[model samples]
Target: MRRGRVLGALLPLLLLATGCGIRSTDVVEVGDPATVEVAPGAQQGTVLYFISSSSPGGLLPVVRQVDDPSATSSSGTGDDGRSRGKQLALLFMGPSRAERKGGLRSELPMSSDQVSVTTGQEGIRVRLASGVNQLSELARQQLICTVAYERGQGTTVTVLGTDGSIGPARCSV
Candidate 1:
C-alpha cells in the first residue's frame, strides 16, 4: 500500500516534467516571393573587379546596368539587373585567417569616392556614391581616391584603381 501511494504521488510530477502535454501550432504561409523590377534609361557596361587579401587571385570582369530612371525598361533594379559584360569580380580583405582563426584580428577601415569615409573599431564604413551602380567609371574614381588615402603599410588591401593598379595590390597579397 505504501508503494502504491508513492507511485501515485510521483505520477503527476513525472507527467509535468515530460512536457508531452504542450500544444503545437500549424505552419502557415506568411508572404509572397520577392521580385526584381528594372527601371528605364539604364546604361550597360563591364567593370573589372577584385577582392583584397584573398589568395589565388580574385580578379574578374563584372557587367552592370545603369538605370536612367526615366526609360521604359522593365528589368530588375540594382543588384538584380542583368549584366551586359562578363563576370563580376569580387574582392574580400576582411580579417585575416590568423585573426579569424585565432580571434585576434582588428577591423580595418574602407571607403570610396561615392561614399563618405567613416571610421569604426573594425574599419572604415563605405556607402554607395550618388548616380553610381556597380563599379563604373565614377565608382572607379572614388574607389581610387578613397583607397589611396585610407590604407596603411602591411595592411591587406584590395582595390580597382584606375591605370591598372589592381595588379600590384593583388600581387602584394
Candidate 2:
C-alpha cells in the first residue's frame, strides 16, 4: 500500500511537470513587414535578412541586394566577388501602399556568437552561433538564446542553417 501511494503521488507531479509546455503565437500581420524565405539552396556566403511581418504605417518597400554571379564573371572580379553571396531585402509597400495607415510598433534584437540582428516591434531577437553550417538542423540540438518578453514564458527561435542543421538559441520573450 505504501508503494502504491508513493507511485500515485509521483504520478501527479510528473503529469503537472510534463503538462507545462511552451508555445508561441506571432502577432504581426502578414504582408506588412514582408516575409523573407531563405532556403538552404539560396544561402551562399553573404548574410540574409528576412522580414516576417511589420506594423501598418511602418517602413514599407525595403531594398535587398544579392550578389550576381554573372555580373562578377563579366566584371572579372576576384573569388570574393564571384562568390554566391547574396543579400535580400523586401519592400512592403508601393507608393499607394505607403499612404495606408500604420499599426503597433515594437522592436526585437537578436545576437549570437555568429551574428547579431535587430527585429522591429516584436520583442524578440535571434542570434546565430559562430561556426554554424546548418541552422535548421541545429534547432533540435541545443538551447541557443534566452528570449525575454512575456513573463513566465519561455521560447526559442531555431535558425535553419544552409546545410539543413538547425542553429541553437534560448528564447523566453
lDDT string, candidate 1, 88-167, tens digits:
11112223354346332212223323323333343333333333233443334323322322133222223322333231
* Worst window of 10 by summed lDDT in candidate 2: 86-95
Candidate 1: deviation at residue 57, Å? 9.4
By summed lDDT, the worst window of 10 consecutive residues in model 1 runs over 82-91
Q: Which stretches of candidate 2 lie over 4 Å from their true place?
A: 1-113, 121-123, 127-142, 145-160, 164-173
* Candidate 2: tens digits of C-alpha lDDT, residues 1-173: 99999999999899888876856667876565665542232222222222223623222222223355242111222222112111111111111232323331112222222333333233223334443452232222222221121111244344433344342344311
Best by lDDT: 1
Compared with the true structure, all predictions reach lDDT values of 0.32, 0.30
